[model samples]
Target: MTIGKTPPRGETIYWVNGKHPWVSISDMVEYGTILTTKEKVSVNAEKLFGDITPTGTLLMSFKLTVGRTAILSIEAYHNEAIISIYPFIDNEYSARNYLFYILPIIANLGDSKDAIKGKTLNSKSLYNLLTPLPPLKEQKRIVAKIEELFDKLK
Candidate 1:
């Protein structure tokens, strides 16, 4: 559970175009898997950003548009407004699909207590958030059920 780097600016920033996929909140889609972003940076920027977020990482935007989630399908660097999670680590009571469905609800429920702007969710907000944690098997079952129900809507 690490937040993204501060965006590069001034001479430290280089537009490398495709060498590095840089994700910002706008690039994320509802329940989408992100393989490429609308922006990119050079190795210089990556160094400044500190890490090449590995593929398959689960990411959620915790800023102004709180709780928009996505899984990275390509190695990428994202802005400070996002946080990346190692899926297999705490992916326990949380399924990617489940989070996609639940986080926004939690964010909305606590909006009045957050920063005096749009509902911005941050690490502290995350730590304070209390959610139901069923067994891992039940989580998987719930995700499957949600998907099945959504598929029926198509």
Candidate 2:
């Protein structure tokens, strides 16, 4: 997991039709896939402000309105409120799939004192959260089961 980067608050980052999709908090969709972003920034702006989050990475918002998760369908840059989550393991796809499903729990583990407007988790809280990591096969099973139940919801 890595935090996304952003330009300064007043910077000129958005363009009418820029070279990179710039995913911000407003662009996120709960348990949805981001094929394209509503906003774009220049290539130079992306180079200066953020790194490219490759396709298939999971993103979760951590500031203001927390707990929204989205799968990246295109290579893009994101704002600081979002974090890129992808596994660095041999079974990359499986591990990431597991994390994507469990992110809502992690997002809600914030302190209760700030529950009125929803809790915002800082980087410290985010990294400190304990997540269950079963074996690769088990994770795949869990993902499959989750998808099965989700399909039933439709």
Best model number under lDDT:
2
* Superposed model 1: Cα runs more than 4 Å off: 16-18, 87-94, 111-117
Q: Which stretches of candidate 2 lie over 4 Å from their true place?
A: 13-17, 90-92, 111-118
Per-residue lDDT of candidate 2, residues 27-107 (tens digit): 877788898887788766765765688998899888777778889999999988799986777375898888888877767
Cα lDDT listed for each candidate: 0.74, 0.80
For each candidate in turn, the TM-score is 0.82, 0.87
> Which candidate number has the best TM-score?
2
Model 2 clash pairs are none
Cα lDDT, model 1, residue 6? 54
Model 2 vs truth, CA RMSD: 2.3
Among all windows of 10 consecutive residues in model 2, the one with the lowest summed lDDT is 110-119
| Clash statistics: count for each candidate | 0, 0
TM-score of candidate 2 against the unseen true structure: 0.87
RMSD values for the candidates in order, in angstroms, are 2.8, 2.3
